[model samples]
Target: MPQPSQDDLKEISRDYNRLWQFPNCIGAIDGKHCEIICPAHSGSTYYTYKNYFSVILQGAADANKIFIAIEVGGRGKQSDGGTFHYSVLNKLMESGRFNIPPPDMIPGTTCSLPYVFIGDEAYPMKTNLMRPFPERSLNDERRYFNERLSRARKCKCN
Candidate 1:
């Protein structure tokens, strides 16, 4: 699948805001383990925490639960963030060529915010990527943010 262009990203963010009431969310990113037979002469490189030989499929789903961008075939030992770090998408973002939107204020708030891709803890937090706070720490505001982000992802899935 082709990566989302700048205009496509804008449309995705709008769709997410309309359907999930989450502002500035262009997509939800995640990684899945796809089971596979270990390849020739490769030892445990494909071995995963799930107790299987696998490859990782890292992808970003738009508001309609459609994959707008996907990267596959990373070794299972790689972390989601690490796989992403080495991806073309990451390179584009790093090169300032991905065309992510400029920072703007969050809806109904005085706080300025940047458009971002939401992901689970396996992904790192950045100006354009968001992840839930560590579970060990609890605060009302942090918990609310995580819950709302999760609900937005769920809305897309359904």
Candidate 2:
């Protein structure tokens, strides 16, 4: 799929805020392993922790669960973070060409925050990406934040 333009990102952020109450969130990103037959001459490259031959499908979706971008065919043995690190989406983000919007003030707040994509613990925390606080140490505020973040990141499967 084509990269989202700045306008597209803005619209997505609006949807997320309206539907999920997550402000300045442009999308939700995650990876899934799809089972597949072992390829001839391929070694353990496709073998996953789940004990299956598969490929990783990493994707970012809008609040309405529409895919905005995708990267597939990553080795199943790779972690979600590892697959994302080598994805075109990551490259675009790293190069600052993904057209992400600039930082803006939060609604009813003077603090400025950058638009970000919500992901699970599998993904790294970056200026444009958000992950929940570590489970090992959690206060009431952090727990509530994790709950909200998880709600926003949830993608219903068909």
Candidate 3:
């Protein structure tokens, strides 16, 4: 799939805000294991934490639950973050070639925030990406952010 353009990202952010009352969110990202027959001579490369042989399908979806980008065939042993780190999408984002819009003031706050993709703890945090605070160290504010981010990321179906 093609990467979302700057205008597309703005619209996606708007839709996300409408859906979950969260601002500056362009999409939610996640990964799934699609079970498959073990490949000949592949060893355990396709073996997953769930104890199955499979391939990973990593995806990013807009607030409307539409996939904007997807990649398949990653080893099932790889975590979502690992798969993402090696993806073409990640390279584009890291190289500033993805065309994400610049940061702006967060809604209802004076602080400026960059538009970002929401994901779970399995993903890394970056200026253009967000993940929940670690559960063990969460205070009230962190808890609130985690709750909101969780709800937004839950837009995807299992």
Best by lDDT: 2
The lDDT ranking, best first, is: 2, 3, 1
Candidates sorted by TM-score, best first: 2, 3, 1
lDDT against true structure, model 3: 0.90
8-80: candidate 2 lDDT, tens digit per residue: 9999998888888889999999999999999998999999999999999999999999999998999989998
What candidate 3 gets wrong by more than 4 Å, as runs, is 156-158
Off by over 4 Å in 2: 155-158
* Residue-wise C-alpha lDDT for candidate 3, range 1-158, written one tens digit per residue: 77789999999998888888789998898999999999999999999999999999998899998999898988989999999999877888899998889997777789988999999999999999899999899999999889888888896432
Candidate 2 colliding pairs: none
Better model by lDDT: candidate 2 vs candidate 3: 2
Worst 10 residues of 3 by lDDT: 149-158
Best by TM-score: 2
Clashing residue pairs in all predictions, respectively, total 0, 0, 0
Q: Which stretches of candidate 1 lie over 4 Å from their true place?
A: 156-158
Query: What is residue 73's positional error in candidate 3, in angstroms?
Result: 1.4
